[model samples]
Target: MAEVNYKQDMPPKGGYAPIVFQNIPVKKYFNGYTMFAGFAAITSFSFYMYYQNFKRRRLLKIERQDAINALEPILLAERDRSYLKQLRRNVEEEAELMKNVPGWEVGTYYGEPIYKTVPKEKLLDPILEEYYAHTSEKAYDDKANEFLWR
Candidate 1:
């Protein structure tokens, strides 16, 4: 086989540059600007993909951290207020809310208006007196029984 001289035979103006390959004795990847353009395209594509992936991961991490920060304070408050008094307040408020529900009114067991049923100390001149006038002890019981009968 005759040894071909590539560089001397090919001119830069004709757009053919020879490449010396590692495995093959004499070969060219591509003879012109086509090869350069193809490599540029692949490199740009890889870089764009890597950048977009990084941006997405950064945004997701920021959102997760924000959610954790928001929830942490609320959890800490609840943990700190776990005392019996707070628990009772919560239960009482919930009970009041339940009473406000329309359906709960049907099951109400209160006999009479407590203020009206209980005896009051009426005087000609209303002065705070130290003495105790016995309100009928069974006033509450009487009111409750009357309501039950109804």
Candidate 2:
């Protein structure tokens, strides 16, 4: 067995420093006023952004309304023309269908007026489906079967 020589380590002059058990207090970098100012700045910026978004939405809505207003007259004219054409067609259909009847008028049951009380009789226009109801059995069946499940 070989012999080994070792030097023992020793603590410097005064023994080890005392162990600290209590927590050390740290100084705050920002005071209450500074923190409050930062929060206010962030909040104000967010509100400004929200206001900008609101303005953009309002502008877009106004533009859409203007576009709709500009197109209204043309659309109304087209609708009127379509309605008059349908009315003419309805009158012709009634005349053809009632040709065999003795005294059946186009808008009335007989030669008498359809509306008696009113000074100016306003005839109710039937919808396209109702106007063609008597033309085909299929149309009648479709109307009858409509909402059957309900």
Least accurate stretch of 10 residues (summed lDDT) in model 2?
118-127
**59-86 per-residue lDDT for model 2 (tens digits):** 9999999999999999999988976776
Q: Which lDDT values do the candidates have, in the order given?
A: 0.59, 0.81
Candidate 1 per-residue C-alpha lDDT over 51-150 given as tens digits, one digit per residue, 9 for 90 to 100: 9999999999999999999999998887666543443554465466677665453213343332564454432221122111122436435644676788
Q: What lDDT is obtained when candidate 1 is compared to the true structure?
A: 0.59
Show where candidate 2 strays beyond 4 Å. 1-34, 117-150
**What's the lDDT for residue 120 in model 1?**
42
Best by TM-score: 2
Give the clashing residue pairs of candidate 2, or none.
none
Query: Against the hidden reference, what TM-scores do the models get?
Result: 0.32, 0.53
